[model samples]
Target: MVETTSHTATVRLPGSKSVTARALFLAALADGTSRLITPLEAADTVAFADGLSTLGFPVDRGGDVWSITGNPTGPPAETAVVWCHDSGTAARFLPALVSLGAGDFVIDASEQMRARPMGPLLRALGSLGVRVHAANGDRIPLRIDADGVEGGVVQVDAGASSQYLSALCLMAPGTRNGLTIEVLDEVSVPYVELTLAMMREFGVTATRQGSRITIGPGTYQARDYVIEPDASTASYFFAAAAVTGNTVTVLGLGRNSRQGDLRFATEVLSAMGCEVTVDDDRTTVTGPTHLRSPGEVVMRDISDTMMTLAAIAPYADGPVRITDVGNCRIKESDRIDAMASALDACGITVHTGADWLEITPGRPHSALVQTRADHRIAMSMSVLGIRTAGIRFDDADCVGKTFPGFHQELAGLQEAWQRG
Candidate 1:
């Protein structure tokens, strides 16, 4: 394990993983060929792109960009076994997409992915006239017998996963019946907006009358799309600024980034006593003399930053309360529990509830953090270890899920800081 050192640095992050993955999926379903510039090449995005190819989408990657010639109507074949690996997006989003083809398809994933929940999305698919075969009650390693979607009204409990709503919306335009999606509870409103924004980019419009959305019969137009730098990944570096009392600038994510996770800086960082600056193509965070507690924050939209704030909690002057992030439980791991447990293992005072966590300011000791193969856990914990000591983890490579070469970038940042 390498000790992290933070100094004033400009960190150029990879493209937004969420946008890249969403674009890849949309590109594969577009009317013509679409090109993606500076797309993220991480494990999850690769899994998404590869999964699309496996399902007969034929993604072409070359030179400075990648292109996909899509079948706007849907996948060309009827029967396919989609290999989702451990990508939650692919595992959840692909089934609805495959429903567009009138065939029997099996959706399977890696061991870890299989452990994640899929029941809600499965039930939502079932309501859309897709025949599902999940012996274990609509989980992964499931099969679908779909004769195309007869979309009408689908009720989704977005509390578990917003991808359920996004998947249905993306496939809605191609469905003969279109779709009227009603959200019982939405975990992340921004994620759904990102989906809607991309759908518009593809020349389709989804009308949302409050909690219900109507989408249909519109064709997806193929166009060149550029992905933004990851706001989630930028959260850690922004935390580095707050913790190390240095300036950290994340390049490429601007003031108007659609990635809702960017609010980590605007909300969490500023509330934590850091000065944040947003420009046209970059955001910079400058640390205060000492970090302060944000008091209480409900991360319904930017819950991915909970770990980042958790990392900074121990240094704050008061307890930090994070609520309304219960949806994080069904992510790569139960992030709330993972974070609480890791903080406990690190000798920090952590109070965990069903959906809320209160972390008290205290000095943390050397601890072996168990990451549970969660990328956010590893990266967020690493941010905490920047100025602290003996923060070790065996599964640091888990960051490859979203930010491949993450440690390399950390090392480079530290090296440059040291040289300065």
Candidate 2:
């Protein structure tokens, strides 16, 4: 079992995996080369590498360097089916690229991915003249025959996953007639903005008018792009500071980040009575005597930070109610259930519903946390472990799926405690 202790420390998070994946997909369609800095080297990114390789794009990954040579002309023949594993980004983004191919390609995933919904994206693809068939009725192992795409006006339900809308927008400019996307009840609007920002960086412009988005026919121009630090991952350190009454500085991020999760720093730190300052590329958070739990918070935009918030609940003075997070149910793990189970095991009072989590602040308890093969679960639980007397985590290796440097960062913080 890995052991950790609470301490005052500063650390930097890796580049946003969500941004890296989207930027790589867009760069692969660009006319030139693109360079990404501090890119996340994890399972999800590896899945994207495999998918891009199958699509005829050359991707090289070593240490912290990721190089991509895009195929602006289009992908080669799909002689084999691509396995996207459990990565929803790969599953959604690659399907749109496959629509430009001349042959049939079948995209399949693990059991967990199959359990996740794909109907919204499939329906939108069908409207764009791509033939898609799902095995077991609207699930994974989707077969795609992409002779050509018409690409006029397409309506997609954005309720389940914003990736569906993102996939369509990224591939819109490549189509013969461009595309217009009408979104119905869209969640995670910030992620959609991230997608549009990345698309524009690659020389494709998209206009968002309320629930509708329009993209014109254009070609992507290859350029060097730097991915910002992951704000979602940074939330853990911010919470650590709040829980331990320490001051922590998170570097390599900004106030103007396209990542929606960046908002979590402001919301969480402010709510916890921390002094926060955001500069061009860093944020500093100073913890107060105790955190004040607002009655309820709408987390639809920053759902990724739910795990981090749950970890800090034990230090709050009152109950923390998280709402508008229905999308969390379909993440790598059912985050709502995973968080509730882990926190409850740690002797925290947790009330859970389909889309909400209400946590009552109390004393920390010793327990073993099961990560459910989810990176966020592992990181959040580890942070909580630092405050508890004795906390063991199952499957600690899950942190490598996103932040490979997590263990090292924890070690540095623990060293500070020992020295003090």
Candidate 3:
């Protein structure tokens, strides 16, 4: 980790992982050729594209711009297995995509991914007339025997992850009868909105009426799409500024960003006493001399940045309490538990509940951070490493899951901060 006290920095991050994954899926299902400009090239997204290729979707992943020839009918393969690695999006979203084909598709995943929840999505698929056979029940390594999805009314419990509803929504256009989804419980609702927005960009329309959302029978029209910078990843640099009382500007994400996580800059950072300025294409955060706590905040929609706040909380003027993020338990790791453990290891006073984390302000000491093979954990801890000495990560390499060059960029920032 790059340890430093200076915090003035400017960062240009990669495309949004959520948007890139959704674009890959949508591009694969479009009726013609689709071009993804500056798409994210990382482990999880590569797995998604590779899985698409395995299912017979022609994906040309050359350079930053990827071209995909969409097949609206479905995957060309009659039988195939998609190894999703640790990508929850692929593990959850691809099964629904493959269900639109007349084949037996097995969606497999890494050991960690297999432990995450999939029941809600599987049950919804089953309700839509797709046969799901899972030996372990509700988990991956499951086979979906599909003639085609004759999508109709189905109910889904999206309390664990909104990807369940987003997955079904992404594939709804290709179904014969369209889809009427009744969401029983929803968390991270903003992600589903992103999916719907992208669907509309590709020329498909959907409507939401309270808990019910409807998508009529149609197919996506292939078009060139440009992905925005990742807001969740930018939170780390924003936190760096807050921790060290300096300024940081992240380019390519501002008022026009479709990602809900952008609230971390416009809302969370501002609430923490950082002067946040959001222009059309960039956001600048000037940290307060003494960071203030944004007490008792609910992170259900922007939970991905929960660790970013937790990392900088020890420097706050008061205790920082984040709540309503119970869904973090089923992420790449038990994110809530992981944050609690990492914060505790840093010799900071902390408390955790089923859906909340509270960190009391105290002088933090150096400790080895355990990343639990999660990208978010690694990146968030790196933010703390900026102000604390001896803050090392056990598995820093896991950051390759999303931002492959995170360490290098952070190191560059450290050097730039020191030079000035």
Global local distance difference test of model 1: 0.85
- How many steric overlaps are in each model, in order? 0, 0, 0
User: TM-score for model 3?
Assistant: 0.97
Error of 3 at 144 (Å): 1.0
Of 2 and 3, which scores higher on lDDT?
Answer: 3
Task: Give the per-residue lDDT of model 2 (tens digit) for 207-245.
Answer: 998888999888888777777788888888877777666
> Lowest lDDT 10-mer window, candidate 2?
1-10
Give the top-scoring candidate (TM-score). Answer: 3
Best by the lDDT measure: 3
TM-score of 1: 0.96
- Count clashing pairs, candidate 2: 0
TM-score of each: 0.96, 0.95, 0.97
> Cα deviation of 320 in candidate 2 (Å)?
0.7
Error of 3 at 216 (Å): 0.2
Report residue 214 deviation for candidate 3 (angstroms).
0.8
Give per-residue CA lDDT, model 1, range 1-420, as digits (tens): 122333578888899888988898788888899999999888888888887887788788774488998887778777788888889988888888888887778889998888887777888888777888885786789888877777798898888778888888888988887899888988778988999989998898788989999997777888999888999899988888788777878888998788899999998889888899999999999888778898999998888888999888988889999999888887889999999999999889899888999999888888999999999999999988877789999798888899888988987776666675
